[model samples]
Target: MKLFVYGTLLRGESNHHVLEGATLLFEGIKIQAKMYDTNIGYPAIELEEGSTIVGEVYEIQEYIWSSLDALEGYTGNPLTDMYSKEIVKVETNEGLIEVIVYTICDVSMKSVLIPSGNWIEYRSSLIR
Candidate 1:
């Protein structure tokens, strides 16, 4: 399955080890979503029209789903999960393809909007 990761799961970020052995399909891919800083070391996204968010796409193994779900606080229940998986189309060099992306389940948890929509860039800005 293809997974789109935009936060700590990205290259060089914390929690990236979860994707060990996965094949990177594309990087710096943009999708229609609004990103936020949960203020908890990772970022979350919400599907929003007219918004573009940057992320990476990877071809992950079936076994990785359990780890990814656990890390995202997803328990297969929308009412309880902090994040929920959604299928969305992303433009890649080859073409447009659908990938599973984790989106914020609770809007109230979003403390600040990440205007750049790129987590890595946003984090760098904080350090500078």
Candidate 2:
């Protein structure tokens, strides 16, 4: 299976260690979804027509999903998990393809939206 990572799992980020052995299929890709800044020091994404969210696609080894699931706080319960793995089509240089991505689960309407879409850029701006 494949995974689309947007935030800390990007090339050079704090949580990127979780994907150490994963093969990067696409360095940059965009998801037609809305992005938001969560209070928990991470970004969140949701399916929204025409909206774009920048991320990376990787072809990971089998059994790595459990580690990813733990990092994403997904425990098979969509009702209370912070994120849930969902299959969505992302636009890459090669073409559009269906891939599993971890999206924010049961987010509140009051969450702040990240208009820039790119988490790395958005996160850097926060420090300045």
Candidate 3:
């Protein structure tokens, strides 16, 4: 399976150690997607665009996806309310492919600030 990542799961991040070792089908490719700033010191996908926010797409085996799902707290339990998994098209080094995008629950994103819609630069500013 393939997935699109932008925030904490990005390369060189704490979670990237696990993700980088997996198969990556896209790198440095930008596409349209919405990235929102959450209070959790990270960002989440709020909405998707037809053609704005963009990131890389990666392909990994079931085991890697399982590990990622666990790390991302993607349980389908209605009470936990982590995120909903949806397939999104992303620009890849080779081309475009539909990859999983984790859009946070509406309630969880209600309190967010919804920055300029760029997760990477927003995060860089935060760290600086």
Maximum-lDDT candidate: 1
Least well predicted 10-residue stretch by lDDT in candidate 1: 104-113
User: In model 1, how large is the Cα lDDT of residue 10?
Assistant: 97
Q: Kindly list the per-residue Cα lDDT of model 1 for residues 3-96, writing each as its tens digit.
A: 9999999999999999998999999899999999999899999999899899899999999999999999999799989999999988898998
Q: Each model's RMSD to truth, in Å? A: 0.7, 1.5, 2.5
Poorest stretch of ten by lDDT in candidate 3 = 109-118
Q: Give the TM-score (vs. native) of candidate 3.
A: 0.79
Candidate models: Cα lDDT each = 0.94, 0.86, 0.68
Q: What is the lDDT of candidate 2?
A: 0.86
Highest TM-score, which number?
A: 1
lDDT of 3 by residue, 21-113 (tens): 577666666556566676776677756565266565777777777677787678876468577787766655566677787777756664554
lDDT of 3 at 9: 79
Cα shift from native, residue 78, model 3 (Å): 4.8
